[model samples]
Target chain A: MDIQAYISSGILEAYLAGELNEQEMLEVDRVATEYNEVRIELDALRESLLKYAQVESKAPRQEVLDGALKSIQEIEKEKFFEVLDDEPEVRIQRVNIVPVWTIAATILLFLSLGFNYVFYSQFKNTKDQLAALQSDQTSLANRVSETNEQLQYAELRIAHFMSEDNIHIRMDGLDLAPESFANVFWNKKSNAVFISVDNLPEPPHGHQYQLWAIKPGVAPIDAGIFDHNQLVQELKIVRGNVEAFAVTLEKEGGSPIATVDKTFVKGFLKKS
Target chain B: MTPTIESKISHLLAERNKEAIELVFTHYGSLLLNIINRVLRDDEMSEDVLQSVLLKIWQNGHNFDSSKGSLFTWLVRVSKNAAIDKTRTKDYRLSQESKNGVEVVSIAESISTGDEIEKLYAKQLIAQLPGDQKVLINMSFFEGYSHKEICENLGIPLGTVKTRIRTAIKHLRSII
Candidate 1:
């Protein structure tokens, strides 16, 4: 490179004036760094410009420095707060819409989050209320089923007692339970026996009332155990002729043989 | 100032020492104010801009790279740019446009009206340069006008504008 030609090209003056583009500036920087004469010439130009500006120098008032110091203190305070907050400062650029849009988007995001939380709480509450309603509905359905079952049992007992073929025998209470009595309904054709206890004493825990059917000159046969609380209960069938019906206190399941001392009630069927 | 003292001041500025601001005001504040004043041509606004420019230097002092240019060159560039930006404002333009011929004439006449004898002599020294060179220097250096702007404003080719600036700076270098 011709050093003198490069110096006279006027690029250094443009560089000093800061009028060159970045690429041109870098090129000038490279040339000035590589060549000693170029650097000296550039420095001389900068000095001349500095001296030219100095010729017109005028001192500012002391108040200006005071104002500058106050401004610097304010800047330092803002920087300190920025450090404490650990949030980057929002720099607003003139003639640009992006920063305004950024602030809007941030506010919208927070609002969306708040709305999401509210909806989630409402959804959870609604779900819990729905579950509670479903439980109530299920309990109501169970109660209706129980009432239906009781109605069905009452209808069956009424139909049994209204039948003409059923023979009802009254069983008187013995000495073990003098106040207790029971009525037995025996279907003539089917030989099905249903016993309805009027006032039977509550049996001990693990003890229940068992009914027996006795035929002439035959041993008493086990009919079935029944809950004293039951108004009407069906017992085992006696296919042959039944001479008498009796109830005895026994264990949970009926024993094969009836205990004589534990008998609570006994009744003889009218000879038909 | 010695390169040693300049390097020390650069280090202090980079470290953000408060003393560096004081030193900057004492050393280069007037020079920078003059750079700003050339563009503004108003004492109050120029003084205000000079304070702001000082604050800007302190805030961005670490960005100054000595390898690019002298600190004084960088300061001049910063002050000139700030002043130029101020002139681009609507308020400045409106004020300039609304000013009567008398105010404009007074502003022009006030450029040479200073108290110091050396300042008067320096003003004459710049006036002693050839008219074309003087105008190029004033437009390019003091006014912060670009080569392209100078070409468009003066109706000269861009090359001629740059060559004249170079020739003018070389002439000022010899005389000043």
Candidate 2:
């Protein structure tokens, strides 16, 4: 093949596009290896295509490439473990001997001290252990006290969260369970809807509980979807005059339009 | 192992030479991204492609034959190929073009030259192409659209799209 002519023919473009058959690819690879001119032409062609592509190229967001680099680092770390496995037994033996000698020396020292060392070491060890235990207990108690304070603070926040003067909608569980109830803390000022599903039962796999705000005569708008994993699901329900809030069992990602048959809970907003 | 290219790469690998890897990244990362962005056009997808390209380089550095081409060329090819493959996917092309329309335009306008001569060269080459060719090249290279998509959008045939792009590329290669 006239490698220079072959490369200049724009077949490399087709090659880059994966349009070439196996034989053509092999032929191009062969010529590229054999002739420097072929390789140079091929490289030039690729570069030109790349340059053209670059003009159209958008700057990739930094975060995406950072994620890739992170994964690459992880892979490289894994490869390090593999390399460690390839060490010779002699090297392993040399590495093992130091720890063994240190252990033996410590045993010898303990043996030399005999009963005197035993009693003294036991007393010392016990005292140190007791000190550690006492410290651990004190720290644990402090942690418990701190956690209790945090718990109280969290409770205060929850109480405050529920108390804010906004539309409160109480959803009574439907045929699924009459006793079960949920609450919607609609903060119109913040345009935030917090769904408290504390009382509701877990939906079946492939199903999620969806909240909908229904106006007097209009179709219900999907507020958001909540799952058992979430104690409270925060949603943004855009301003729409609605008479009531309803909950329905929908597919995992929520439905665009609500289905009545899957209705599990309903509640009318309390008028201020 | 002797101090061949393979050995050097292996040593770098064994040492977990982040500096060397980072050097490669800082040097070629943007250029590679530029190539990918040319093909995919959507910033996120292009970024995804750029990552895959870098990962391939890291994993397969030993496979690189410097005797064949420079590392930059190899990276460009890999990035472009990955971007092209991603663009060729039905879901990627459809979702990207629709969801990322305005963002793509803004990104194109905001592309920083950052005082790099190569970047300037690339910018000049792109600028020098005829207006229609430039648009077609931009759509084809950056957005990762097939010639058919370009043709359909511009009301041109596939053959014209391919030839004009090929000619534009040839012109660029000559100038560069």
Tell me the DockQ of each model, to 2 decimals. Answer: 0.24, 0.13
In model 1, where do residues sit more than 4 Å from their true spots? A56-70, A73-272, B1-6, B18-50, B63-128, B152-155
Question: What lDDT score goes with residue B22 in model 1?
Answer: 75
In the predicted model 2, the residue pairs found to clash are A56-B142, A57-B37, A57-B38, B38-B141, B38-B142, B39-B141, B39-B144, B40-B143, B41-B142
Candidate number with greatest lDDT:
1
Weakest ten-residue segment in model 2 chain B by summed lDDT: B1-10
Query: Candidate 2 lDDT, tens digit per residue, B1-176?
Result: 11133335444644545543554454445555655665565666667777777677667766667556545445556676787788779878687767666754453443333333244346764556555555544455544455665676667876676666666567666665
Model 1's CAPRI class is acceptable
Taking all chains together, the TM-score of candidate 2 against the true structure is 0.39
Candidate 2 runs further than 4 Å off: A2-5, A16-26, A48-67, A74-272, B1-42, B60-126
Alpha carbon lDDT of each predicted model: 0.76, 0.66
Per-candidate chain B TM: 0.59, 0.50
How many steric clashes between backbone atoms does each model show? 0, 9
